[model samples]
Target: MQYINFLPCEWNNDHGFTQEIFAIAIKNNIGIGNPDTVPYRKSQMKNSYQFLHKYKADINTITIAVQEPDYTYTNPKTSKKFTQAELYDFDKNYIGANIIFWNIQQPQFDSVLKFFANN
Candidate 1:
């Protein structure tokens, strides 16, 4: 199944004007929640893991992934490009924070494993 970011902007061009079209697209495709919305994506991850644990044991894996945006903001009027380093510093703390968050969410990952082990 194809996957798309659940962005309202994309729905207009790809799924038509109405939300019914958007819902149809979601039903047809593998609609991963938007990365920009952390809580929504996190919930999606939990639900997906649970589903995989129940039905797709071979494919289920604990994935603690973090994706920083590829491009920095560019000034449209000035035609100036801002490098990632210039926009935001990538440092140890950034890595540490994600690690901490991943650790905090380990129980959810563990549940998937426990489900598999029991069955």
Candidate 2:
């Protein structure tokens, strides 16, 4: 089974935990996720893509999750209790090499394993 560590872009600048996760993945020969890169605008996406691509990792194993902009549900009357569908449409439109949806609630671990097992 392949394991891809999901790393948010916000944590890229602060590589404390991110680096640790990356190190573990590298040591184990697992994959890594670059979700933050997909959210970048046109100009920024290029650099983000470059940075991730330079890792020389297996692109097919990478995953990216994008949240929807209007994915919010508040209480009917009170301003309490709410949930948002963090996976956005753009998240599904990533053209990066081997990018797949890494839904926050439903990660691809089980599905990916099942796919490979079935194959």
Candidate 3:
């Protein structure tokens, strides 16, 4: 099966937009209703930089990633053209953030990830 886009219907356009999204993370989650205000012991917090470095992963470390936008694709349903660029986001805290804003329309590189309404 082809990948289905989960973007909202209203977001359909010639190009896409950027926004903040919450991603699912697996870890221990102490109950919030615990009577104790400071419930379970506080686990050591690892900032974005710490997490990325722990896996020996960095944006610039990848060679097959998109570093420029040299092509564009059209939306089948809307016939609206959109730029096709592959990107992987790294935490801002990560010192080796090698983000490249391929398309000029895209805003300056940041920690947020961009997705198209039409996959």
Candidate 4:
């Protein structure tokens, strides 16, 4: 059987929901679903990747959903938004580290489930 780890941005606030989803996904052999609402600094993303790798999780099997440039913020000090180029650049740089990108605006849940089913 396959197992998928679903991580939500609000996991800290909704542990029960998180656990429920994780359990269901694991039992069904589906893909993990991670929210794109939370901002993940480059360092944090790298550290997370490292931690997962350390735990023997296949990097290729992991995917991170991210908001579109219009919805993503530039920084805490300013209300500026990130450009598409910047977002692509960040993903490109991190892609080699074994992270796949998914646009949250799309029907990611179904798409991910299908992806896992096919793979």
Report how far residue 96 has shifted in candidate 2, in Å: 4.9
Per-prediction TM-score to the true structure, in the order listed: 0.22, 0.35, 0.17, 0.34
Q: Where does candidate 1 stray beyond 4 Å?
A: 10-104
lDDT of 1 by residue, 1-119 (tens): 21223434533234443344334544554332222212222343343322322322222121222233223234344455433232222211221112111112443446434543765
lDDT of 1: 0.30
lDDT (CA) per prediction: 0.30, 0.41, 0.24, 0.42
Off by over 4 Å in 3: 1-60, 63-69, 83-98, 101-119
Top of the candidates by TM-score? 2
lDDT digits (tens) for residues 1-119 of candidate 2: 23333335533335555445545665776755644423334333443343344454533355554333212333344454222221232333343335555334443345434544765
Q: Can you rank all candidates by lDDT, best first?
A: 4, 2, 1, 3
Task: Give the clashing pairs for model 1.
Answer: none
Worst 10 residues of 1 by lDDT: 91-100
* TM-score, candidate number 2: 0.35
Model 4 C-alpha RMSD to native: 9.8
| Predictions: Cα RMSD each | 15.3, 10.7, 18.8, 9.8
Candidate 4 per-residue lDDT over residues 1-119, each given as its tens digit: 22223444543324455445444554555544333323345443433322333332433343444555424466443446653444444443433223445564554446544654765
**Model 3 lDDT tens row, 53-98:** 3422312231112222323333344455333322232212222233
Output candidate 3 Cα RMSD. Answer: 18.8
